[model samples]
Target: MREQASYLRIADDLRRRIAGQKWASGEQLPSRAALAREFGVSGAIIRRAQEALITDGVLEGRAGSGTYVAEQRKRCRMVRFQATGQAGAGYRGPDLGVLGEGETWEGRSDVMTPAPAEIAARLGVDEGAYCVRTAYEHLVDDKPVYLTTSWEPYDVTKGSLVVLPDGGPLAGAGVVRRMAELGISVTRTQERSEPGTTNAEEANLLGVQRGTPCTRIERTFYSDDGRAVETADIIVPSVLCEIVYELPVSRS
Candidate 1:
């Protein structure tokens, strides 16, 4: 509707263009001033549209340069691992819940980034080494619900489908899922969840005001021999997920 907010209108128009393939991967987008005139809105409104595209991974803007269309791919999908109750089947096929579309899993090159001291200690790896990092962000109805970063030894993950260069269903499926397939079944799961404030990137993606309160869920998965295989930092907006627990009481 014309009465809609200017930012929303600009975003809607750009969405249509991207969906229609008007811009291809690596294609440059019009300058802000140009877009403003096209939409009959101010540059501020144009900036809003660009921000939305960047968050959605449809476009990437380079500082001092121009914006370019990002490669199109299935960025996000439903990954449901049932913890208990009727949902206890585990993260199988899609259709777990409405994890509104976007990059559910993002694969990056096999580059080494120095792990935080805590992460290095947990993984038992040197601070600097070839590590394959895969990042994942999940959304429910187009808003960020979960964010995770996973690291695997380069020798273990190289030549594997860790990074979706061609952009297909997220390989690794998730560390646990892939590990189980490779005969490395997880025997124990440790989780430490607490409340915290959302960071700048998460705040923008989740559509929450910056520094909004959020829940931080840290999980470390181990094999039977006490080998730590994977570590994940899961940032979850409480509004989208609820944690329920069941405790058995001792009989008197």
Candidate 2:
């Protein structure tokens, strides 16, 4: 066990070195044999340390190439339900905090799709019910940061200009504003978040390795009548973002 402990210590030291900028982003790391010699450890120990860094997203390996320092990932802040007074072209803009500035979002909306069972349950609608779904990818400096999928019951939005989230005069006006146009007032929202691992699709979208740690959030918007106006799933890489929730305190 002592030998195992030594490799972990070596890994921690290597991480510190990387954080200290001993090797710049995209710069190839020293060979395993070299690292082993420098650390007075076996090549296996050096390999294990490098593998740990690769999994943590601090380093990346290229086919037919050596491992290199990964590009610095921006730490985006995802604020839940905190209106930013910001409007985008095709979706309700999020309270991205510091990341809001200079950030660009691209999205696609599809109407009259059958709602999946999980989405139906969240919206309190029958399984296979038609709904409008929109998928969004948020980017910073032209790099994908996060992805979101939102669903709204078709019965409520059918035949309305706002049925397509990215269409009509109120395009991207947000759920609250769009619902208000139909005399529905969104009074509250609920969100649940948990840790998750990236799948192949998510990995490709976010430019991270499969099994990378990520944050999964489920959010639902409720009207004054307690009807679910919209529900969405948000996926963000844990290494690149943090989720913050601010709750109001009641004064009796």
Candidate 3:
């Protein structure tokens, strides 16, 4: 069996303490040395514990200031598949119940881009094969909510008006319809999601702490003929949005 680390044990205790109102939201925590003495551990261990909390969004660390309890936030629900129901638009905005139809997104697509090893594998293309790469930032009232980077194999859409995921006759038109215009019917999509931490660039884009908790989704669209037409990586900040998948239920 895998064992929990020393700092993780302390972090659990700290979480309990916060739940009991040991420090109110936005309230600074004790110094590292003080917490170390209280826990009978070294200062370094205390620092690790606090850092873990910060990464989990329970604590905030200021450059010169000490750690503090993070303020509680009401995260909005983001439902998948709802975006596909939208009509006329090439790019489908998210289905945030709170944001409603007010959400706006902008994207830039680059043609003939070389696919990285990871993305190429998802698209079933060789490394460095040409593909169309597009990046999107979804927002509500100008506040960034989430980000997506998509890759589509060039050979699939080449010579077609839908080559550019965001810049064709069906611009903003999602992958399924765009491929349909090229006689390629998208049959299904597969997604794998897991918890992650925001890096420096993602932190800046989402306006959150460097190590803030996030949801990372690796999604791919498949054609009826068993070909991967497009793949994307989506990043959602945990503090601002909650990821919920609404699977279809058969009433029969």
- For this target, which candidate reaches the highest lDDT against the unseen true structure? 2
Write one digit per residue (lDDT tens) for candidate 3, span 175-201. Answer: 877888988888878889899988989
User: Clashes per prediction?
Assistant: 7, 0, 4
- Global Cα lDDT for candidate 1: 0.61
Which regions of candidate 2 deviate over 4 angstroms?
1-23, 27-69, 81-98
TM-score of 1: 0.54
**Which tens-of-lDDT digit does each residue in 145-252 have in candidate 2?**
888898999999888877877678877667877888888888878878899988878877887877978988898889888999899998888876776755457698
Query: How high is each candidate's TM-score?
Result: 0.54, 0.70, 0.67
Candidate closer to the true structure by lDDT (higher is better), 1 or 2: 2
RMSD of 2: 5.6
- In model 1, where do residues sit more than 4 Å from their true spots? 1-90, 93-111, 159-172, 245-252
- Please list all clashing residue pairs in model 2, or write none if there are none: none
Q: What is the C-alpha RMSD of each candidate to the true structure, in Å?
A: 10.0, 5.6, 6.9
Task: Identify the leading candidate in terms of TM-score.
Answer: 2
Minimal lDDT window, size 10, model 3? 90-99
Ranking by TM-score: 2, 3, 1
